[model samples]
Target: ELEHFEMHAEEPSYWPIIAYPKAWSPSAKGTGEVIYLQIYGEEDLEQYKGKLKGKFVLIDTIRNVSPPFEAKASRHDVESLFEMATAGQPTPRPRRRNRAGGFNLNKAIWTMLEEEKPIAVLDRSYKGDLGTVFVSGARTAEGRARDSAKVVIPQATLSVEHFNRIHRMTLKGETVKLSMDLKSSYTNEDGMEHNIIAEIPGTDLKDEVVMFGAHIDSWHTGTGATDNGAGSSVMMEVARILLKTIEETGIQPRRTLRLALWTGEEQGLYGSRNYVGDFFADFGDSGYTPQEMKPENENVSAYYNLDNGTGKIRGVYLQGNDAVRPIFREWLDPFEDMGAQTLTLRNTGGTDHLPFDGVGIPGFQFIQDPMAYFSRTHHSNMDNWDHLSGEDLSQAATIIASFVWNTSQRDEKLPRKKSQEEELEEKREAKKASKAFKAVDPAGSWSYEVEIPGMQVTGDMVIAKNGDKFDLTLTSDYAPDEKEVIEGVQIVDNAMKFDYQSEAQGMLIDIKMNLDFSEKSIEGMMTAGTFGSFPVKGKRNSM
Candidate 1:
C-alpha cells in the first residue's frame, strides 16, 4: 500500500507559489503586500522593527545566476586520484583575525524577525538555479529551531528566478503580492533520538569489534537519497551480504562486526560523538578534550564510514594513519581493476567517522567519485532517488564488505596514531627536562612596547593566576586613563593568547595578542582589527 510521505507545499490556488517551506517552520498562513528589506547591521535592523508587521518580507538581495558552463557531473580521473594517493601533509594556514565588531548579521536578522512578527520571511537559496531551492531548518534568536521553547516563524527559501522576479517588481514601484500557507508541525516534541546499533558475534575474539556505518538523517527538502540515504542503504546492504555469506559458509568471523546507523549527523555528528563518549572515551566538553579512555577502547579495531554520495569507491583516504597504507594497499589489490587502489594520508571531515578517529581508533572514509553530489544534490531539493546511481552504490558496498571482512580476520588490531593525551604527556616531560636551563613564569606585571606602522605605543600588562585560569589586564600609555580587562585568556607552555575589545576614535576595535615569554622578557605580535599585526616586546617588572 502506498502511503503519503513528508512533502513541502501542496498545489493550491495560492498566488504563484512554488517554493518550499524551511524545515522546522511552524504552520502559518497570511496574505499581505510583499516588503523588501536589506538589513546590514544593528542600526538597520532597529529601523525596520515596527515596519515589517504583517508583511511578507524579502530579506535578501537578488542573486546572480550564471549559466552552467561546465559539466554538472564528473568522476575523479586517474591524475586526480594519483594526486590524492601521493598527497602529503597539508600546510597549516595562518589564523584569520576576527572581524572588528564580531557582529553576526544572520542572527541579528532572525532576531529582528522574531521581534517584529512578520507574516512570513523569504530569502533566495544560497546556491542552485532554475527551480531547485536548497532548504534547511528554521532559525531562532537563541537555541535550535526544534527546541521546545524556541519560536520559529514561517520561513521558506524561494527559487532564485522567482526571488529575482519579485525583487525586480519591488524595485519598479510595483506592488508585488504573494499569499502562502505553510502547513508544518512538530512531531518529536520530546526531542529524543537514538542511534541504531547491531552486531554479529564472533567466535574466538568476540570482545574485539570491527565497526561500519553511516548517518541516517538528512535535510527535509528531498528524500535524502544522495546526501546520506545512499550511504545508509549501502551499509544495510553490506550487513545483508555479510549475514548471507556467514550463513552459507558456516564460518564465523574472528572478531565481532558491529553495524551502527547513526542519527543527528547533519546536526554536527552528535549521535556518533555521544556513542563514542558513552562506550570508549570520556569527552569532557568537546571531541578534542578527552578526559579518559575506557577499557572498551582497546577492543575496537577500526571503523569504516561512507557518506559522500552515490559515487563509486575510487580509493580510500587514510586520514593521516600512514601505518595502514600497506595493509590497505594489499586489501585493495584485488579491486585495483575496479578503480579502487589509491590510498592517501590526507583527512576527510564532516561525517560520522570523525568521532571514532578523534578518540585514536583507526577510522576511515572511502574516496568516492564526485558525481554531482556537491553541485546539484547535496542539501538541496534534488537530493532524491533519481540522483542516486545503483551501480555506484553496489561498487561501494562490495569494497566496504571486503575491507570489513579483512579487518575482522586480521591477527592484530589496526595500528593507531599517538593520541593527544600521550603527546601532551611527552611534551610535559620534555619541558621538565629543559626547565633548568631557562625558567619563566607569566605571573607578573610587564611593561611592553608595540611598534605599529608609524608610531610606537607602550603598555602595562598585569597577569595573575586564578586557579587553573589566568586573568589579564592591559593599559596603554597612549590612553593612560582607560584600562581593558581581558577574558578567556589561555596560557600554554610559555605562550599566552587572548582577545579583547578596545575603544579608539569612537569605534570599537577587536584586538588579539599572542605573546611568548622568556626568562625575563616577552615577545610576540599584537593584531589590531584591520590594521594588521605589530611587533610587541616587554620586560618583566622587578618584584
Candidate 2:
C-alpha cells in the first residue's frame, strides 16, 4: 500500500520553478501566458489556434543544459581495464536515430495540445542543469493507459535554468505568468506486477536452479539510482550475503539460489521477458526468437546479471559463450583483488540477461566499472542516492556472491552453447546467401547490370502492389535525375529490406537495399550512404 502523488505549483516571485506533474496529469488549475509552441505545422496550428486556449504551453526547444565539467564519477582505470580486456568484436552500436519520425511528430503535437485547450504543458529538461527537474511521462496522444488516458494535457518538466527563463521571457516581449496545480493518479491494482522472489533451498539440487537478477524498474527521473537503484542494490546485497553464508557455514545451496527482483525492466525486457516466457523458454512473440522449450528449460543452472551502474565488478560478458572462457576464468580467480579480472568474448546487449540469453540459458552479464554509467547516471535526473558506490556496491556483492556460489555448487549444468535449434540453424546458413532477393512479383519488371570502376551500371525495378503496400521503382543510369521510390517493402526470411534517397553532386545519397528472392534471380547488398557496399544482381522480366 504505497502509492501517492502531489504537486502544487504557484510560486511567482519572478523565477525559481521546477514542475513535473504529468503522470496522467489532469487536476489542472490554471494561469496563462507561458505559451511557446514555436512552430508546429498546419500554418503553426492555425496561427496558434486562437492563441492556445489559455496557454502555458512551451512544448520544446530550449535545451541548453550543461555543467558537468567532467568526472561525474569514475573507476575502471588500469587503462580502462586494459581496453575492456583487449577489445575487438564489439561493433554494432550505431542505430539509435530512428525516432519514429520524431515519435510520430510528438504524437501529432500531443494531439494538437488537447485540441488547443492548453493551460499546462511545459517541457525542457532533457537532462538537468541549474534547477534539476528531469521528470518523465505525460503527453498521451494515443499512447494512453495511465489508467487509460482519455485526453490528458497537463504536462511539465522545467529546469534547464527554469526552461531558459521561461524561454527568454517569451522572446522578449515578456509575459510569463504560469500557475499550475497538476495532480496525478492511477493504481487500481490487480495490474499484477511482481518479481521479487527469493530462495536458497538446495541440498542435493532442490529442483536445480541458480538465477540472480536486477532491474527493479526505475526512471521517474532521479532515485532510480544509477538507472537501476544500482542493480537493485547489488542484487539485494547478494541476497544478504547468501543468507549470512548459509547461516555461518551450515552449508546448503547445491542448486537453488534464485533471487529475481525485476519488474518491467524499463519497459523492454518486460519483467525478464515475462519470466522467460513464463518459466524458461518460449519466445512465442518472436522476442529473443527461441520458439519453445520449457520444463523449466532443463532446470536452469546459470543466470547471473547485474546491470551496469555503480561500477565495480569488471569482467564477464561472455555472451558469445566460447565455452564460458574456462568457466569464467575460474570465477575470476577469486576476484583478482576485487577488480574482478576481465573476460569478454563479446555480446553484451541491454539487460535482464536477454531473456536468459534468449533461451539457450547459461546467461550472464557482469563486467561493470564504467562508472558514471554512460556519464552521470543513466536516464539522468542524476539518478540519485547520491550516485551510489559504497565501494562500488561492496565490490558488486562480493563478486556476485562468488558467482552465485559457483553456479550453485556445480556438478554440471552451466556450459550450454548452441541449441535453440542449433542457433536458429546457424542463423539460417548465415542468411542463406541473402535469400536471392525475396519478393518482387507484383506483376514483374526487374533487370540489372553492374561494373562500377567508372560506371557501366544499369538498372530497372518496378514491383508494385497497393492494397497491402509494397512499391518500388528504381530506374538508374546511376542517378539519372534521381526518381527513387522505395516505400515500405518487406519480406523477412526470404529477405528484402528497403530505404532510399538520392541526389549526388549536391549530396544526399543514403541508400540501403538487401534483396534476395530467387526463381529467375535477384541478389543483394547495397548500403551506399558513406559510399561503400555494392554487389547487386538481378534478372526476371518476362511477364
Candidate 3:
C-alpha cells in the first residue's frame, strides 16, 4: 500500500520535536499479531497539563549522530545488489535507507488506538552516501497521524557501516545494546513563532485588500537559507520595492496591499489562509458567478509565486486558466527582453497557493527554472546560504515587485468568474440521485439546437462523459450546412467577435465578447481573457 501523507492549513514552525514512524516488527512476545511502531507527542504533556497525558506519553527526541559525515546501507544504490547477483562477487550491498520499509505508520498508530493498545516507538537516524545525517520530522509525523501513542521519538545517528553492523548482527541472532536519553519541557512559549507582515495602504480604497507572501521558516539543520529564507527575503524585497515605487511615484493604489512572511509554511499554508479568512464572518460565501467559470474568466487580478529556489523565474504558470494568459504575457513582455518573459499555460498547485485555491479564490503559482532544486537543496541538509545565486534572486524580486505594482494599480477589483449555476445544480442533482432523493435532470441530458445564418448553435450544452468534445457547427444559411472547424473569432464586427466555442460534440460554451482594448493599440493588446460584454472602438469599427 502506498503511504499517505496528510497536510493541514495551520502547522507550527520550530517544533523542535518530530514523531516519525520507524518500523514494524514481530508483535511483542512474538504473538505474531502484526505490530506497528512510531514516536508521538510532547516530551512531557503530563508535566504541563497535569493529566494522565490522555492515554498517551512520549520520551526522547531526535538524537543526532556526528554531523552525517558517513553512514550504512542505502536502498537506492540497487546497482550494487545487481552487480553482486550478476558478477558473483562477495560485495558490500548498500543499506536500505528507509523508515522501517514502506509501512503506513500513521494508519498503524490509528489502528492500535482503536484496539486500545499502548505502544512505544523508536525513530532511528540513517547514514548514507550523501555524507550528511539529518533528524527526521517525527513529531510532525505524529501530529499528522491524528492518533495517540506512547511515541518515543528519539534517534541515534550511525555510520552506514555501524547501522549495517546492527542489522547484520540481528540477522545472526545477536543482540545490540542501544541506550538513549531524550528530554524536554513544555510551556506556552513552546509553540510561539513569528510572521513577518508588511503593508502599503491604499489611498482611495484602503478598506479593500490585496496581498502576497511566502513562508519564513525552514529546517534548522541548515541555515534554512534556501528552503524558505530565500523566499522570505525575496518577498521582503518585494515589499521594499513596492514601498519605493509608492514613495517615488506617489501613485497611491486604490486598494490595500500587504506582504506576509509566513511561518510554518514549510508545514502548511498557515499564515496566508488565516489573513484572507480572518474577516470571514464579515462576509458571506463570495462565490464565483457563472461568468467566472467560463473558459476565459478565471479571476485573479494578480498573484505572484516563486518557490523553485532563487532561480530566475523563466515564466509564469497559467494554472490551467488561460483567461489570464495574455495579461501575464503583457506583464512579462518588458522582462522577456531580459530572458524572463515566458508564460506557460500549465497548472501548478502544490505549495501555499493550495489553501487559497481550495476556497475558490483565483490563486497563481510561478514556474521557475529547475536549478538544483532536487540535485541539491530542497528539504535536504545542503539547503543553505552558499547554494544561492544573487542574479537569480534579484531577477525574481524584480518581477514579483512589478507584478504587485501593476495589480495594486489596476482600475477595478480584479476580474473574477462565477462558477456555473448549471454545473452546481447538476452536482446537487447527482448527489440527490445517489441518495435516492428523487432528484433528476428534467432537461433529459442533451443539447437543444438552433440554426443561425452562418452557424448551428448546439442545444443547451451537455457535458461529455469522457471530457473531450467541443466543436461549432456551420449552417447552410451562410455556408454549406456542414460543421466548420471553429476557427477562432471568424466574424469580427465593431472590434468584437462572437463564436460558439464547441468544446465538445453537442456542447458549446458561448463567447460574448468584451476585451480590454489597451488605449493606444489594436488586436494584440486585446485582453480576451478578461470577459465582459462591453464594446471598444477600433480601426475596423466600434462594437
Candidate 4:
C-alpha cells in the first residue's frame, strides 16, 4: 500500500528546499543563531567572513507583497483577441539591462559564502504574500554546475510574513534562530538526458514527419505548472487525441505526427537544439549559422510548439514566411469560433521552435493570451496546477491537434520561404546597393554654402571616384588656411558620409559631413564638434 504524507496546517508548513549532491541530508534539529548577510558587494563579505558558518543566513531583504485580488487567470478578452488577430507587430520584449556588475558581484558573494560555509541560505519569496513560498535552484559557488565539481549548499525560502518577522526581530536586537533538516539526492550516473518522442506513423509518407512539441523541464519551484507543465499536458493530450482519432476514424496521416517533449528548454533550448543539430542541420562553430545540412532536413514538414502558458491558442506567428499566409488562413477558418484565426508575419522567439526555424524549417509558436504567466506564475513558486485553466488547455490541444493533422495529411509538404542562404544573398545584394551610390555626373567640382547661426560660409568641393569608392576635397571660406580631404568613402544610395578636421579660430575642430547627390544639386550637413551642425546646399558650377 502507498502511504501519503500530507501537511495539515493553516499556513504553508511544508516549504520547499534545494540542496546540492541530491543525496545529502541534514538531520540536525534545534534553534541556532541566524545571521542576515546583507552583502551586495565583494568587500562586504570580508566583514562577515567567519560569522556565517554554522548559522542560517538571510540573503535577501523582506519585501512587502499583497495578495493578487485581481483576476490572475483569464482567457483573451474580446478587444484583446481582436487586436491579437489584427496586430502586425510582434510581442515587444522588455529591454534587458547590462547586469555584468551584478553578475560578477553575485559570483564573488557565492564564492565567499561557500568558503565561509553557512549552515543554510534563506530568501524571501518573490510572490505569494500570505503563505506561498516560491523556490528555485540553489546557487552553486562557482555560479554554474560542473560535471566533477558541485558546490553544495542547503537553500530554502520563506513566506513574506514569516521572513519579515525574522527580519524585524533581528533589526530590533532580538536574536533570531532557526532549525532545519534538508536532504537531497543527485542522480545522472549515465550522463544522459532524453526528450520524449512518440509518433503516429504514416503509411505513404512514413519518413516525412510533422512535429509538435513543448518543453517538459521546468524550474524546481511550483511544479512548473503554468511555466511549462500546462504545455506538456496539452501536447500529451494532443498525442492521445490523435491516437484515438486514428483508431476511430481509420484515417492514418500521410505524414507522421511526432510528439516531442523536450527537456533543458529553460536552460537555453538545449534539448531541441541538440536534436536539430544531430538530425537536421549542423549548427557549426558559431551556433547560429547552418554549415552542413543533413538529409533529414528535407523530411520535416513543420514544427508547432506551445509554451506561452495556460492560454488558449489565438492564432499563429508566421515567422516572416508570407507564402503560408493563405494556407494557414484556410486552416484557421474551421476554428474561427474557437478564436484561432490570426496569422501574423511577426516572429516570436525564446522557445524550442527557434532551432527548427534557424535551419529554415517551417517552425512556429502559437499566439496565446497573457493569462498571468508573466505577472504571477512563470518561474515563481505560485506556478502550480491551480493556475492552469482546463478550458484553455483543452482548446489549445484541440487546435494544435488539428494543425498537426492538417499538416500531416496535406498533399504536399508545408510551403517554405527562402532558405537561409538565399536570404543571406538577398541581404548582401541590398547592402551592396545601399553602399554604392549612383554617379549622377562625371567627376566635377560643385560650389556649396553652409548656413550657421551667425555666419554663412561658402565652399567648393571636388568629387572623384576610383572604382566604387569616392573621395572629396573641400576648400571653405570658414577655414581657408586648411584644406579638408576625405578618401575611401562609400556612398549609400546617393548619400556619402565623411570626417574631416579644420583649423578654426586657433582651434583644431573635427567635423562630420553627410553629402547627398542629385543631377542638379548637392546638399549636406556639416557637424562641427560642440559648435553644432549646419545645413550646406550646393549647385553644380557651370564650366
The best candidate by TM-score is 1
Candidate 4: clashing pairs of residues: 22-184, 22-185, 22-186, 23-184, 23-185, 134-381
What is the C-alpha lDDT profile of model 2 across 1-543, one tens digit per residue? 113333333333444466555444666776766777776444556667767877788867777655677765576678866765675432111111222223345556667778887777777655556555556556566644254436777676766777787788778876668666555555644566787888878888779898898888887656788778788888888989988998999888888888998886764566887888888777665454557788988899889888777878888877656787888798889778877888865556557886787677888888787766665567656778887879988888888888898888879878887633354345445766564424445436888764332134677887776545566677777644334666556554555667655543222345666666566776655544422334467888854
1-543: candidate 1 lDDT, tens digit per residue: 012222222222233645777777777676677888865556777778788888888877888989989987889998988888888632101222232221345557778889888878887776788778777666666566766767877777888888887888888877766767666666666777899999999989889999999999888878899979999999999998899889999988999999999998876677888899899999876344458999999999999999989999998877667889899999999997788988987666668777887778898889998898887888888999999999999999999999998899989999997643354345445755784635456778999998652257898988887666667778887656456666445566676777765644223445767776777888766655433345578999953
TM per candidate comes to 0.76, 0.32, 0.51, 0.69
TM-score, candidate 4, is 0.69
Model 1, residue 505: what's the lDDT?
25
Least well predicted 10-residue stretch by lDDT in candidate 1: 1-10
State which candidate, 2 or 4, has the greater TM-score: 4
Q: Whole-model Cα lDDT per candidate?
A: 0.76, 0.68, 0.42, 0.70
**Which RMSD values do the candidates have, in order?**
10.4, 20.3, 20.7, 15.5
Candidate 4 per-residue lDDT, tens place, 397-485, comes to: 99999889999988899988775335434544564577553446425788998765224789888878756776666777754533556
Q: Regarding lDDT, does 3 or 4 come out ahead?
A: 4
Off by over 4 Å in 1: 1-15, 90-107, 285-288, 420-543
TM-score of 1: 0.76
**Candidate structures ordered by TM-score, highest first:** 1, 4, 3, 2
Full-model lDDT, candidate 2: 0.68
